[model samples]
Target chain A: MTTPPETTTASTAPAPVLAPPRGTRLTLRDASIGRQGTPVLEGLALDIAPGEILTVVGPSGCGKSTLLRTLAGLLPPLAGEVDRDGIPITGPDAERALIFQDDALLPWRTLRANVELPLAIKGVGRRERRARAEGWLERVGLDGHGARLPHRVSGGQRQRVQLARALAGEPRAVLMDEPFGALDAQTRAGMQQLLAEVLRGTGATVVFVTHDVDEALFLGDRVALLGTGTGRVPHVLDVPRPRDRTAHDDPATVELRRTVLTSLGT
Target chain B: MTVRHLLRLLSLVAALGLWQLLTAFDVSVWLRFEQFPTVVDVAREFGERVGSEAYWQDLTDSLSRIVTGFVLAAVAGVAAGTAIARSRLAADLLGPVLEVLRPIPAIALVPVAILLFPSNEQGIVFITFTAAFFPVMVSTRHAVRALTPVWEEAVRTMGGGRWRVLGSVVLPGALPGILGGLSVGIGVSWICVISAEMISGEYGVGYRTWQDYTVVDYPGVLVGMVTIGALGWLTSTAVEVLGRRVTRWLPRTESRAEAPAPRRSPSWGRSLAGAADPGPLTSTKEA
Candidate 1:
C-alpha cells in the first residue's frame, strides 16, 4: 500500500527500466500429463527451443489445455519428466505466465491494476509498476483505457489486457490456452497479428493452444497436433517461414494444413 | 413521480384504508377485526410516543443492541466462512458444530440465553448475534466456493503465494455473496432480538410492546410493530446500498445502455453486435 514516490519534475513519461526478457528452454521427456490420476496425453516428448512459438492444435478433449498446464507448472505431469532449463518444475513459477481462454482478468480490478498484478506480486515499486503497466497497455493498443474494469470493456479488450498483464511480468515463457478463441473472426485475426508483433522483441517462449487449424498454422513457428484418441503422441510439424495471412494458399502450407486437418479428422 | 412509484404508494394507502374500514365497521369474520386498533388510534398513539423520553430510551436501546450484535456477527461470520471455504482443516473443525446449531431457531434459545448471560441485554444481543451468524456464514461459504478456479491459477502463475491469492482473489471475489448474507442476517437479527427482548425483562421496544399488550393498550402495540417494521427496512436497505457500492465492479445490465464506447477501436462493432449478451449479470443477484 505504499504510495509511489513524488516526482521532482513535471514530466509524465515513465522511465522504462524493464530488463530484457530471456526465453527459457522447456523440455517434456516422455511425459504423461492429465488431471487427477487419469493420463490425457501419454508418452509426450517435446522440446521447445528458446524464444520459439509452438502452437498446439487438437480436437476437443485431446488434452491440449492439459499440456499447456503441464508446461506452466500448474499441474505436474502424472508420469515422466517436465523440466525448464534442465531443472524439473515442481510448482507454478513467476518465470512462466499463463493466459486463459476465459476472461481471467480480475473483474474487481481496473485494466491497469490487472496488468500491474504480477509486478506487485514480484514486489516492484509503485512508480515502476505504474510505468510498466502503462507501457504494456500501450503495447497492446490499449493505452488510455487502463482505468476501465474488465466488465466495462469488450471481451476482446479484456483479452488485450490479459496479454498486457502477462507480458508485464516479463516472464521467460508465456503459456496461452485458447486466448483468442472467444473473439470474433476479425478480432481474433487482429489479436493474432498483435500477438506476433508484441512477441517479436520480448524473446519469451510461447506455447499457444488452440483448436483452429488456421490459427495454429499462422501463429506457430512449429505446430504440434494432438490426436483426439488417448495414448496418441503429438505429431509435430514445421510451418513454412515468413508468417502471413495469404501464406495459407501456398502449396506447401496448404498441404500441411490438409495433413493437420486430416490427422484431426475434421 | 413515475407510474410505478405512484402505484407502490397507492398499494400501501389501499391496504391502510381497508384496515381502517374493517376495524371501524367491526367486520369480525373468521378473523376478529372488532378487537383491532384503528389506524387513527395507532397514529395518535405513535404521535404521543414520539415526543416522550421513555419511548426514545426504548428506541435507542433496541438500536444499539441490534447494531452491536450485527457488527460482531458480520466480522466473525465472514472470517469463519472464508476459513471454512478455503481450508480443509477449518472446515473439518468448525463445519459440524455450525451445521448442528444452524437449524435451531435463535428465538427458541430464550431459556439458554437467559441461563448463560448475566444480563437481559446481553442475552438479547447474544440471541441477535446467533440469528445473524448462520445466514452470513452459509452465504459466504457458498460464495467463496463458487468462485472460478481460473482466477486463482492466473494469480499463482504470476508467482503470488497463498496469502496474496486470498487477499487479491478469494476475498474480493466472495464479497458480493458475503454482503448478501449480511443483508439476510440483519433481517433475521431484528426478528430474534425483538422476540428475545419480549421473553425476558427489558426496556426496549419489544418489552414496551409486551407491556402495552398486558395493559390492553392495542394502539401502543400497533405503534411498536410499525416502528420495528420501519427500523428493519432501514437497516436492510443500508446494508444493500453498502453492498452495491463495494461490489460496483459487478456488471449491471441496466448500465450497459449508457456505458461509454469500447476502449479499443476494433471492439466497437463486436460490442454493438453482442449488445444482447447478458454477460455475468444472471449470476449476480442484487439485493
Candidate 2:
C-alpha cells in the first residue's frame, strides 16, 4: 500500500475524491470492558479482519455497546489489550469514527455543516471542506436538503447525514452502536441497503452492534453473538452469503440464523 | 388583521376604558380612585414631558446605565459561568463565593454601591450589573453543564482538541440557555437600575418620579411611571426577539402547522427516490 505524504499544512487538493482509506485490523485479546470501574463483558478473544463488517447482536444488557466503546478508545479496557492494526488503542482517533443510535447530528448545524465537522477538525480548507461535504451529502441522497437544519429532515434522513458525517472523515474503521435501531422497519431496511451501497470502495472496517437478528445476518460478513454474563467468549459465525437480502431463505443462511437466535437464547 | 391580534388590541383598550371610567367618575370603591390623576390629566402630562429636555435627559441617563451594565454583565457572566461549569478548579474557587453573594437582593446593595463608587452614576450602574450578573451566570452554568456529552465525544473522535470542542460545541449548544438568561437579566437590570436611581440618582426617570411625588405632581409621577413601563417593555422585547433570531434552528411546531401538505400519498416510490413526505415525519410508519 502506498501511503500519501502527511499534509501537515493545508493542501489545496483539487478533487473532492479522497484516497480509499485502508481498513484497520481490530483485535481484542481476553479483554475486559465496561463503564466506570466495573467490567460488563469479560474474557473476550476476537480477531476482526481488515475491511470486514462485523455485526454484534445480543440481549439488551449484554454490554455490546461497552465493547464497542472500548474499541473506539472512549473507554479503557478493564483488563487485557485492545489493538487496532497492532497498536494499542489508548484514545479516540479520527481514524476510528463512532456512529450513535441517537442520530447525534448537532441540532444547531445545517446538514452540510454537520457533515463538514470532521473535515474541519482535520484542518481541511474551506473550499475543499464544502466541496467534500456536498459530495458526501449527495452520496447519501440528501443533496438538496443540505441547507435544512437537522430537525427539518426526517429521522431517516438525519441518519443518512450522520452516515455521511461518519464517512466524510474517511476513518479506517467505523464503530456503529445500533445506528439504525431508531428507524421504522422499512426505513431501517432502506438504510441497511444504503449502508451497504455507500460502504462499497471505502475499505473501512465496520463493527456494527444491533439487537435485530435478520439485520445482523444480512449486513455482516461475520456475526458475533454475545451471550450475557461475565467471562464469556462471544460465539462468532460466518455468513455463507452476505449482503444479499434474498438469501434469507437459503438453507445455510437459515441454519446460521436459527443458531444465532438459539445462542442469543431469545 | 387576524382575530387573535384584534382580540389582543381589544383587551388593552378595555383595560384603558375601565381605568378611565373609574378615575373620570371618582368612583372610590375601596381603592382611592378619587385622589389619582384622571386619564386625560396623565395623557396631557405625558405630552408635556415628551417635549421637555429634562425628561429626555432622564430617559437617556437611565438607558445608558442599563445598556452599559447589561452588556458588561452578559460578557462577564458568560465567561465566568463557562469557566466555572467546565473546570473543577474554577468551580471550587468561585462557586461558594458566588452562591453566598447571589441571594442578597441587588437593590439592597444601594448602600454598598454608594459607599464603593466615586459617583452616583457609577454606583447605579454597579447595582444594575449586580442585578443582571447572577441570573446570566446561573443560567449559563446550567446551560454549559447540561450540554449533551455526545457532542463533545463526536468532536473529540474527529481529532478536535479541548479548545476546539469548547468553541465548536459547548458555546453554540449553551447559546439558547444563555439567551434565556439574557432576557431575564435585562428585565432584572431594569428593575434594579430604576430602584437604584430612585435611591441616589440626580437625573433619571426614577429620581424625577420621586421628585414629582415630593412636590405632589400626581400627573408627572404617572408620566414617569408610564415612561419606565414603556422603556422596560421595549428592552425586554428587544432581547426576546434577538434570542429568537439567534436560535432559529430550534424546531418550531407552529411552522409545521402552516406547511403545505404532502402532494403525494405515502408510497414506496417517494421512499425509493429518497424524498419522503414533508409532513411530520414522525407520523409516517411503514406497515
lDDT of each: 0.87, 0.87
Q: Across the candidates, what are chain A's individual TM-scores?
A: 0.91, 0.91
Top candidate, metric DockQ = 2
After superposing candidate 2 on the true structure, give the runs of residues whose Cα lies further than 4 Å from its correct spot.
A1-21, A241-243, B1-30, B33-35, B255-258, B261-287
- Model 2 per-residue lDDT tens digits across residues B1-287: 99999999999999988888999999987888987888889999999989999999999999999999999999989998999999999999999999999999999999999899999999999999999999999999999999998888877777778898888899999999999899999999999988998889989989999889999999999999999999999999999998987787777777663267532343322453355434433322111
Best by TM-score: 2
DockQ, candidate no. 1: 0.31
List pairs with backbone clashes in candidate 1.
Answer: none
Tens digits of lDDT, candidate 1, A1-266: 48656432324222332543288788999899999989988888999988999999988899988988888888989999898876788999799999999669999888889999999999999999999998988888777666777886777888888998999998999999999889888888878888898998899999999999999999999999999756777889998788698776889888999999988888
- Kindly list the per-residue Cα lDDT of model 2 for residues A1-266, writing each as its tens digit: 37655532214222223553378789999999999889998899999988999999999899998988899898999999898876789998898899988748888888889999999999999889989999998787777567767776677788888899999999989999999898889888888988988888799999999999999998899999999999899999997654487776888888888899999887
lDDT of 1 by residue, B23-128 (tens): 9999988999988999999999999999999999998999899999999999899999999999999999999999999999999999998899999889889999
Chain A of candidate 1 compared with the true chain A, TM-score: 0.91
